[model samples]
Target: MDNASAITVFTLSGLNGTEKYRIPLFVVTFLCYSLIWVANVIIIVTIIMDKNLHEPMYILLCNLCISGLFGTAGFYPKFLSDLLSSTHVISFPGCLLQGFVVHAYIGVDFSILLIMSLDRYVAICRPLVYHSVMTRQRVGLLVLYAWLLPATLVMVGSITTFILKLCDSHIPRLYCINYFVNKLACTASVANFIIPACTYTIYVCHFVIIFWSYFYLIRTCRQSKEKMSKFMQTCLPHLFCLKILGVSLLFDLMYIRFGSVDLPQGLQNFIAIEFLVVPPILNPVIYGMKLTQVRNRIAQLFGKRDPMPHKAEFLMVEFESSCPNPPQDPFEGTQHRHEGVSLNQDIIQAFSAAACLASGSRHGLIRLGGASSGSHTLFRHGEAVFKLKQQVSELLLF
Candidate 1:
């Protein structure tokens, strides 16, 4: 344990065996792993196939689903194997690869989540500029960077860390994480914790700022009483995502702060399984249940139909608009069509004369206007009746 050459491969003694519970544990974990895989795949597929879900928010979700898919795929197979066998041991190379993949996908997931938050911020606050700000090209670049940068950084870091390790044999917890595996190094120094602490702190600060900004955003939206309900509706889903993220962070911090730091042979493996394997399984279930859209989509996939609220609303508007306006004038009289609903010039002229006589001596009573042709005289009252008839005809026609 003291020398650089002391360990060649790590052995993991997983969860303390309670002989009565092994089969149930294996069955439960297996089903969870299977559900996670299938659910994430469905999410990805729905995002791709549904045009309604092709917006920036869903694009980010699809990226997250892909991240979770990879994250779970990277560790679950090994973890499941361990659960089945009740043995925890990972080869050196397998541990390194697992650590790298975990780091890469997790980094990518957070990076995308931050971008998604920004996307929501813009959509809610500066909706007019959201499209311009989150154009397809810009979002695509962010997605690429979210994935590639993390993969590259983790690859570089993992390779260097693996090379620096003095011992090849260290039993990783049920699976491997960078920190869990690094804990076994005879040469590990304060730098291991220091580097990760700084990196994690930077992300933590970013997350704090983003949450504060969203707080201001929610306040600003609430100021408009008209949008209060809609604001809540939109904010709820994002809030759920934030809550889950916060809960995960809380678990991580609590474990690091209060849980044992000592790298006991059996304990590291258990931590690995808890940290890497459990969270991924929880994500889709937590978010899926909290997000109405995802739940509705799932319901649809299961052949349940959600009545289109907007369409019904539109129909209601149309129906109300179709209801006849309260009768305006009793003498409005039934309109007659002449020359395919063109006004009846002779009749209008007659009515104009009667209206003028009945109204008494008016200065503009018989005011006549030249027609567009400059030859025909258009009587004022006649013109009024003519326009009224035209409007009535148009309305009826519609």
Candidate 2:
């Protein structure tokens, strides 16, 4: 039997037809990699900085984004370099390491999504005990378990493949996968079959948990509008993410196990790489757009940091100024008329100054009702104040 040590490198055949479009492919790959980093980093940072976002769902989401970054780092850099190279080969240790990272990435993704589903279930289905069930300590443990379990499983799988004697050193896909490495073994060990089968079965249970959580979530939400609204806003993004990952994984698994040579090489390649490309890009975009808190936090990160007072603040000031009541109708008597005009002027000046600051401009004062001759001027000032107030309100909302 030829020993595993004999094969120090494996040639990847996935780059077979990439020569004609290598440059274009490299450019696109580089851009996609950059985007994945930017998007994932933004989410991670947004979650980390905001104390309000330190909840279970957001924490799981942060880990999920980190997993995307981890998984892509395993593929894109090497793939980018391979695109520009003549020989597409990876050293044995490098191959094993890549397989470990890619596999761990996928496993962690499933784990985090599962945890997220459980989180949603608790938050929506069992709201009263969510805090007790998913406390800070427990959430930390869950996240740790999510990452650690996958890393341990993949590590064992990589080690199992590492010990095998190989008769061939060719990998059909663009990157190293443990299954492909196992295929290269001189003889299939029962452990190889059993371990992966068990791993798949375990993750299938995860899928079941996800589906079950969502089932109850859907059922519970239907009875109440508030729960239904929460489900649509938060749970939908998770479902979309799960669907995207599931489809990509299904294509890769199907093609790897039962794919025929009759299929086009391009289509085969696309199927193989879909999981690596789509999920990393799509997860952040979906969550950033769909989750209101995440969206607002992201906006706040890129937006200016001036604090705008709330609507209640404006109302409070109005309340305080009007507290000292005078006549029922100030304009009814000439004696109290000057005081009313002065009070009105003070209110207008204060609001105008606030509006100017909120608008980041200082042009003119917003005049109140003065004379019929200047009614047009007052109308114009009123319009500007209305627009300024709207802008301030929008800023405060974010």
Off by over 4 Å in 1: 1-7, 18-20, 189-194, 261-297, 310-398
Point out where model 2 deviates above 4 Å.
2-4, 304-398
Candidate 2 lDDT = 0.76
| Per-residue accuracy of model 2 over 244-363 as CA lDDT, tens digit each | 999999988987888897888889888988988899999999999987668777877999442532221122111111212222322221211111222234344435443442343232
Model 1: per-residue Cα lDDT at residue 33: 78
Candidate 1 structure quality by residue, lDDT tens digits, 70-157:
8877877876676666556777777788878877877777787778677767766665456678888999998998888778767766
State which candidate has the highest TM-score. 2
Please, what is the whole-model Cα lDDT of each candidate in the order they appear?
0.58, 0.76
lDDT of 1 at 189: 66
Error of 2 at 54 (Å): 0.9
Q: Report the lDDT of model 2 for residue 23.
A: 98
TM-score of structure candidate 2: 0.77
